[model samples]
Target chain A: MAGVDMDMQILIVDDYKTMLRIIRNLLKQLGFNNVDEATDGAQALQKLRDKPYQLVISDWNMEPMSGLQLLKEVRTDTKLKDLPFVMITAESKSENVVAAKQAGVTNYIVKPFNAATLKNKLQAVLGAF
Target chain B: MTDQAETNGHEQRLEALVSRYKDIDPDDLVNIVEGIINTAQGDLSSVNLKVYGEIEALSRYIHSARQEIASLRPDEITDEHIPAAGEELEAIVGATEQATNSIMESVEAIEKEAETLPPEVAQRLTDSVTQVYEACGFQDITGQRITKVIHCLTHIEEKVNALLETFGEPGERSARERKANETSGAADAELMNGPQSSEDAISQDDIDALLASFD
Candidate 1:
């Protein structure tokens, strides 16, 4: 596979600070250094509007707003509609996957994923990493 | 001679009267009455004793149950203890995040410094750094599980508070307390399920299969 751009600005969103850090570290291992963090989808949306992020990796469950809700908002917005969105969730229920698919998520990754799984999902979404 | 004969006849009638009355013994009649009275008194006393014992046992049981309920006050379970535990968990998560960030930063620095080293040695160093990064991933899953635990504790606290309100005191119930009581039964089933086990949760492959069906 060809090399992935290490400078692609990515946003990692989760309610847990530890989750955000772990994702940030994982992205760093995959050679993506320009990563921003958000505690939830609401904050992630704010950051998304304020800055240009090539990719969004977000947890599914959160207070006030969820990753799926954020995805819907992104899909509805004319400017950010085509942005790549990857959902990170602990649930792999069929209904949840279908909902995410209908919401136009680029890809889905389950929790407790290793660097290899992350790489594969990134490759699938962003192409040849 | 005629007077003597009449006296003898009267005497014979008197003897007959005496013989008929001989079958009725006053001593025996008195003994039978006394025995019946004694048996009735014994039975009555035994019944009364048993009833008193049962009443005493029931009273003791009720007293014990009341004490148990009193011990289950909101202060014991719902007070600062649960919230404090949640705060402690939050602090641990925060510390873990900080430590993980430090490790990542150090790894990055090491990776940068490994540029001038032998190719194999640099690759090994990079691999080791990657291992550290992967190890830090535990914090995320652990944090997620702990969040669930905190949520459970919060639910328990709500229930304890509601119990205290309903059974605690008269006229001390607030609107919030009433609302808590009303909504206590309405907890989300998903949230209440806590952390799912491997058997309970579907795998990524299952998700992929479902997504594939969408196509």
Candidate 2:
């Protein structure tokens, strides 16, 4: 879903650098130019504070810190609060989903999702669809 | 706990059946049907009472999901009936994660209990764990390697269980297979990421020489 002229900064957080690159390229293809990358939740937090990002696309599982943890941290922090956050995961676990929802994730996308599904989930999170 | 050897053997038979399904008889269909019926009768909802129980669990999940959504203040919250899907997902993912955790726990328990046994037994347990780990697709991020490993491991696990039943020890082949896997895994990682140091890259013969570790 594209509005006439509004740019949004999207932060892609994943432990796998390859996954981050893939998501970054995918978002760029979708016409979102302002994009950033982080390897884990902690790094994501640092980046979030260093600059403002309109959206966050994160993986559910990672060492040191997790996507859910990042979501909670983002929601709890006053400045970064209300940022549109999405959880992308291979884990379809109910508790994981519940946990993500509880942490204020704007939406959840299961792994192996296509570009269409990614767009749909983003729209759902942004309330555009 | 159920006998791992028995389970492994059962899985191997399942694998053989899946791979050679074209050869199975029309009569075997009756047994397969019976198995499905039995599982559904025991594990699936056979009556309203069981269905109600499942719905109750689902309702709780839905309620929580709704509360979370309301707080996010989206542009418009479409009633996607997330709880219904959430309920189904909870059951499926919860069961899988529980099963995996249970198996890992059993392996850990066996390892701990076997500590007092001979060194050979301990080695076997370690190898068994390694086999299961690889089979479960721990190393490969692509998920294909894990799928193939799981298929093979399921067969091997069944064989290992049977060997344990007969010999009072895990199967030797499982450990040997695990060792082979480890060697190949290291080689695979090297190939994908390249060697840790340039000095290790002697020649094509050098790569062949390194493979001796697996052998």
Error of 2 at A58 (Å): 0.2
Tens digits of lDDT, candidate 2, B1-215: 35788778876877677678877664576588778778765455346667878899988887676566446532121122232333444465445545555665576567567678798987787556544533332211343223334435445545544534353332333322333234333322222221122343243233223323333
Judging by DockQ against the true structure, name the best candidate: 1
lDDT of 1 by residue, B32-146 (tens): 7678878764455556889988999988987776567777655655556787898999888778778777887787789788878999999898788767777877676667677
Q: Write model 1 residue lDDT over A1-129, tens digit each, in one string.
A: 366566889999887676676678678767888999988778889999999999999887765567877888899988899999998877556566777899998888877677788888899888887
TM-score of each: 0.68, 0.39
TM-score of chain A of each: 0.95, 0.91
Clashing pairs in 2: B5-B161, B8-B157, B8-B158, B9-B158
Q: In candidate 1, residue B21 scores what lDDT? A: 86
Scored against the true structure, residue B112 in model 2 reaches a CA lDDT of 64
| Candidate 1 vs. true structure, TM-score | 0.68
Kindly report which residue stretches of model 1 are placed more than 4 angstroms away from their true locations once superposed.
A1-7, B1-67, B170-195
